[model samples]
Target: MNIRPMEYVNRERINRSKQLIFLEPEQKIQDISMRSGFEHPSYFCTVFKRLEGMTPEQFKKSHGFGI
Candidate 1:
């Protein structure tokens, strides 16, 4: 089953989370989840990976701390 409204919200939320991931690499994924409108951290991880093409940790490690 597909949900149009939910999909739209999901996309918007994913974009915001991507920004958070870039702007706050020091923050843990759970923090990002809470800040980005997600109540569940594990669910955030799953959805984030699906949309962003990589896990949050991998994104941070790839571009964080000057490397």
Candidate 2:
């Protein structure tokens, strides 16, 4: 299957978000979202939930981060 441009961008954002979650657990969600190239934290959370099935905070908690 061919991937669309937005799909690639979304995937990259998710990957970067995951990296930030692991590498910088202490970082704020807004900062992580910005670093992942999201213009707004709310939008980032929406996309992340759609892709990952859980919010970033939940993902972090699952990975043993205090959030």
Candidate 3:
């Protein structure tokens, strides 16, 4: 099976996403999107929510950040 470029996982992107999630729990998705190299905040939110099965706020709250 051939994997498409978009479907392939980039470890660096994953790491950046993790850092954005952990280091800036209180920051808005727009700011996180920029810092994480995502040009579109909405697209970022979509991708993030898809990968994690929830919004950023929900993820933070579930991880004990308390919203």
Off by over 4 Å in 3: 9-14
TM-score of each: 0.79, 0.94, 0.70
Candidate 1 per-residue lDDT, tens place, 8-63, comes to 78778888887987887777789988888999999888887888788777777777
Candidate number achieving the greatest TM-score relative to the actual structure = 2
For model 1, what is the C-alpha lDDT against the true structure? 0.79
lDDT (tens digit, per residue) of candidate 3 on 35-57: 87778878777777777688767
Q: Which prediction has more favorable lDDT, 1 or 3? A: 1
* Candidates arranged by lDDT, highest first: 2, 1, 3
Give lDDT: candidate 3, residue 3. Answer: 60
In order, what lDDT does every prediction score?
0.79, 0.94, 0.70
